[model samples]
Target: MAVKIYGIKNCDTMAKARHWLEARGVEAVFHDYKALSIGQDVLEGWADRIGWQKLINTSGTTFRKLPDEDRADLDEAKALRLMQAQPSMIRRPILDTGDQLIAGFKPDIYENVFK
Candidate 1:
């Protein structure tokens, strides 16, 4: 796959990431979770590369709102299912650089990775 930035457009962090990439003139395909559907296979591939722990957005409200039981005892399969069911539960701006899978945004990390 080519470089893709998977995120929700309205997300503040996503906005920052977009601006960062735009300022750098880095071309990337955007996968807006709110505007389009993310396939199970896609999420699975991401999980394989990044690990389900990093892929899941535990900091987000969607994940916090889930029942304790639902969030409990999560493995790759369970986390993948939850993320597939609620795309918002996936970390914002997962940057696929066509070589590596970045699960979340960090300017320094981005700098090093993209540089």
Candidate 2:
């Protein structure tokens, strides 16, 4: 299975996820969003899979720093555009294993999905 992991390289959760995969001898292609931008279609696909709430990182500083109006009533299209413009607004450690798409990195979830 070809596993592709997407996130910012310096993110703590992403680092932990990478370490977990490495320790388990799982080889995954890492796609750093900052370095390689994701297009609107891809973002939409992810949102469709995980839902807007799951894809959007409202807890992150990037989202919190946005103007109140910007965060006020964001729909799917708007959220996708925002995430495309600022990849950090998306949740970290999105894993694509051909057949499945996993967003975020909880060890238990990773263990269950990746295994």
User: Which candidate number has the best lDDT?
Assistant: 2
> How many clashes in each structure?
0, 0
For residues 1-115, could you state the per-residue lDDT of candidate 1 as single tens digits?
6679999989999999989988988888998986796899999898788788998988889999999999899888998889888899989889998888898889998899779
TM-score, candidate 2, is 0.95
TM of each candidate vs. truth:
0.94, 0.95
Specify the highest-TM-score model's number.
2
Q: After superposition, which runs of candidate 2 have C-alpha atoms over 4 Å from their true positions?
A: none
Clashes of 2: 0
Candidate 2 accuracy as lDDT? 0.90
* Candidate 2 residue lDDT tens string, 15-45: 9999999999889999999788987888988
